[model samples]
Target chain A: MTKRAGRERAGRFLAEGAQAVREALRYGQVYEVFVTEIAAARNSELVDEARAADVPVSTVTDRAADGLSETVTPQGIVAVCELLDVSLDEALAEPKLVAVLVGVSDPGNAGTVTRVADAAGASAVIFAGDTVDPHNGKCVRASTGSVFHLPLARSRNITAVFDACRKAGLRLVAADGHAKTDLTRVDLSQPTAWVFGSEAHGLDPEVLDAVDDVVNVPIFGKAESLNLATAAAVCLYAGHLR
Target chain B: MTKRAGRERAGRFLAEGAQAVREALRYGQVYEVFVTEIAAARNSELVDEARAADVPVSTVTDRAADGLSETVTPQGIVAVCELLDVSLDEALAEPKLVAVLVGVSDPGNAGTVTRVADAAGASAVIFAGDTVDPHNGKCVRASTGSVFHLPLARSRNITAVFDACRKAGLRLVAADGHAKTDLTRVDLSQPTAWVFGSEAHGLDPEVLDAVDDVVNVPIFGKAESLNLATAAAVCLYAGHLR
Candidate 1:
């Protein structure tokens, strides 16, 4: 399940670390859990919980756990979980706030944004265009198990995703650094879907034009712009406040 | 310098990539710039700007640039620049807003918070307690040049730092997830210093008790909590809106 192809073929991914494994078990899609003796002892409650759920638990050597982990230091627990993403229609049903990532290739940024969206109570997160897979091990680890907390969707056709959101009564707004409209001026009390672009280059012109509005996060200091995840957090939290 | 001790003894740090090197040059403390031939061609204006400023520019092999970088893929440009930090008194002098990190060990989180604080127009960022050095290679890279744009101060004694903020007429507010006071209720319009803790363990009880007010960023979703940087961004940007 290390490679995207392998995960897609098997419809499963590895959730590393105690926090992720525990969340996976709660989501009720865990197939099996591999834990080292030390980890099993450290997370006795979690092991018991997995056993109660009838999920198979296996003890492995530290070396085996290390081989299964993507981090420099293995957390000694790993869970095999079924893919959690749903269709756009299902995810956007009655949505109030959504976060859309377009051409965001970095797994860490993708996962961080997902975690932020979840914290802000966003209804769903859509990985549009060439965005990284949420099931990627690094992305899963970065999310700290948020990948199991909410509805997620992946679509190659961003336009169709936007259509689906609009059909569900969401106003499409792109967060652009150079946009003339400031984020504070936008009426976020209404249902909205925020679109974020890659860290390297912002939203494509066509995508920006397709949105109902484009708002910029004001930069009050000398820094050029906000990081992608930082911008997403600020924007999502703003909507949450409303 | 890859090591913190070496950087401290020499009073110099390496700023890697075009954005960081450009910012270092603009800040007017660059001693030398080393760039690979390809990077120089790609960033000709940056090279010319360095030469015009009377700073030495050396063309190096890709291997040499790789040695100086902390990333998997080297951007092929590195600048040796003076350490940029000030005394706590100097940083807090006539401050209206500040971001304080206590016991934050992740260099990337530290740098990202610094960038977020900078974008929010914070007066300064203080690294209190046993925090990662702002001059660390990953921290610098993650900051993307914001380190040079704002005043920074580091101190081992977190109590003294809190006292300094209070003496400077700034209210000390810690971002605690479990605090009773919601972030929305805080009067951020006043001069305030926002305190944050490590990702693994939150603020110590003593630290929380010392703050003038402890506020929580309300998590409206199923997420257990927000990431360190995400919480910081939301808190800082909320203050920015005021």
Candidate 2:
């Protein structure tokens, strides 16, 4: 399940650590949970909850738990869960605030944005155009189980995603550094989908052209620009607060 | 320079990669630059800038470059720079907006908050209590050169730091999850110092009691809490927008 190919083939991924395992049991398609003796002792309530849910909980050796974890210091618990991504239509249905990631290769950044989008009450997170898989181990860990709290989708065709967002009555606003409009000046009270690109190279020219508005998060200090996740938090929360 | 002792002993640390090296040259007290032949060729303008600054740019073997870098894929440009931290008095001098990190052990989280604070035009970033060193290699890399763009301070005594902020005529506001006040309701127009704690265990009880105000970033979704950097970004930018 560590490899994307393996996960796709099995239609499952491993959610490691206690928090992830618990959230998987609560809000995700958790197939089975493997826990070390110590982890079972520490998370007895979680194990009981899993058992109550009719999800099988197996106590494995520490070595087996280590094999299933990606972190150096394994939390001694892991869960096999069905991939959680929904279809684009399902994710964006009646969307008011959405976050779209285009060509974001960093798993940590992608996951952090997903978590931020969830915290801000965004309707969905769409991974578009070469973005990292949300189910990747590190991405899942970084999300701290928010991956189970919201709808997520992946689309190779970013243009079609933009069209669908428009069809859902969302104004596509690209968060670009070079844009003339300031983020604060934008009227975020309307249903809006905030489009963000990779931190290295921002939105492609064509993608920027497809957006309804391009706004820059104001940078008042000497820092060149905000990272993808930070910018996403501000943009989504701006819409939420409005 | 990877170890805290080594950096403190030499009174210097390394700025790795092209962006960090460039920013170090532009805004920091750069002692020297080590570059691989390929990196020099790729960053010719940066090399020229170093030369124009009368800084020695030494070309070294890939093996030597690898030895100097913390990253697996070395960008092959590293700059030795003087430590950038200042005294709390200096950092908080006439402050309008400031960020304080208390007991944040994760270098990546600390660095991300530093970058966010910089982008939000915070007056300074003060690492207090048991926080990770701002000079840590991963922290510097995660900061993406913003460490060079702002004033930073470190103090083992978090209480003194808070007192200093109050002494400097700024309100000390702690970003806690269980706070009574919502972040949107805070009067951010006043000069404020936003205090943030580690994601795992939040602000200490006495620390929370000491703050003038405690506010929570509204979580409209099912997420248990926002990560430290995400909360800091929203808090700092709220002050910036005000």
Candidate 3:
């Protein structure tokens, strides 16, 4: 099946590996689960969760499982569940505290930012451009199921999103590791849309151009940068709690 | 060969693949680098750095590379250089501010904590028990090379580390995430030692048993937990910068 086709087949995205599957069982809004014969037989935890949840569980060939997987290493288990579908319009109407992730490719980093957003009381998390899918198992797991709880979705038109946010009385705040604006000094109580970029390339230039304020977390060490997720967490925490 | 022996022979710790290697180059303090015949011929950025720095470089077989590697996928590059040894005796001599990592397994998490400690200007970082090796390429990279710049090392006896810290005037602050004390409000100005635990389990009873205060980064949303590295960063940034 095509990648999008596979995504469409299961309302929930595919998540693999024992730990990720375990997390799905515990926290993911899992509708149903599928496992290959080898994996199901070998990983009793998967079998137990499938049995305990009384969710429909089935077996496929390892090759079949491989074909369905988007990851390099598929843990032979997949779950189909409902989409998170947090609405931008709803979030804006309420508080206009939104988080936009731009071009972040790493699932772990993206998931982490979602977790940070959720922890910080972000009303929504908007993904723009080539950012990885939140439903990717790694992203889902990295989120620790925060994706299941937050207002999150993928949006292609970033400038338009910013425009709408501004129209809703939200200011765009971009987080740069090197920006001179101190996070502690930023006024975060107002309606705001905090934007973070890809771990490597950071925010796209176009997106950067649209931001109302470019801010930074001060760094006083020899290390050139913070991990993307860690940086996002600091900003989000500062934004909400400050 | 045994893991320790393999590292000893190469004068290098195991780094898994291209990503890990990229991280090491970006993050590790020790710059001396080497490449397997295959990796050098691939003419990637790492090989370029090795050549540019005029650091001693060499090539070995993929098999040899794997043997020397510390991860599942070695990707044919490794480095041999000094792992920094940090001394707390001096930092303790003044106002003793230390951060301790307990039972953290992910090298990335461990490294990022080290980097944050440096950024927060904590006098030292003390790893208690089987935390991931600070010098491991992944951890080093994750730290963004923070391990090299700070006073840091592992302690077999966590109690002693805490005792030493407490005696030197550091207040033991443990982050429980659910704790009632707001981290920002807590008096972190004292010589402080912040204790963090593994992502999966959080602070250990023994470690938490030793803390002077337990604090939380108040969450306004539904995230179940923060990424290990990100949580540490928030606490350090909020409480440690002097």
**Which runs in model 2 stand beyond 4 Å of their true positions?**
A36-38, A60-76, B60-75
Of candidates 3 and 2, the better by TM-score: 2
Worst 10 residues of 1 chain A by lDDT: A233-242
The residue pairs in collision within model 3 are A12-A81, B14-B70, B16-B73, B111-B143, B170-B191
Cα lDDT tens digits for candidate 1, A1-242: 87889899999989988989988999749999999999999999999999999999999999999988888999999999999899999999869889999999999999989988888888999999999998988888778788898899999899999999999999999999999988888987679899999989999999998999999999999989988888999999886554
Ranking by lDDT: 1, 2, 3
Decoy 1 TM-score against native = 0.92
TM-score of 2: 0.91
Report each candidate's C-alpha RMSD, comma-separated, in the order given: 2.5, 2.5, 4.6
Provide the TM-score for each candidate, comma-separated.
0.92, 0.91, 0.81
**Model 2, residue A208: what's the lDDT?**
93
The top-ranked prediction according to TM-score is: 1
Error of 1 at B69 (Å): 5.2
Worst 10 residues of 2 chain A by lDDT: A233-242
Q: Which DockQ values do the candidates obtain, in the order shown?
A: 0.67, 0.64, 0.48
The alpha-carbon deviation from the true structure for residue A138 of candidate 3, after best TM-score superposition, in angstroms, is 2.6
Task: Flag the better candidate by DockQ, 2 or 3.
Answer: 2
Query: Each candidate's lDDT (Cα)?
Result: 0.91, 0.90, 0.72
lDDT score at residue A197, model 1, on the 0-100 scale? 98
- Cα lDDT tens digits for candidate 3, A102-218: 888898888888888888888788877677777776787778667766667676777667776787888889998766786776777788888898777877666767887888777
**lDDT tens string, model 3, B1-242?**
12545555655554445544555455554345557777776757777775666666677777877776666766677666554544555546665557788888887778878887777666778877778766666776666556656667676677877777887878889988667787767887666788888877787766666788988877778876677777888888875233
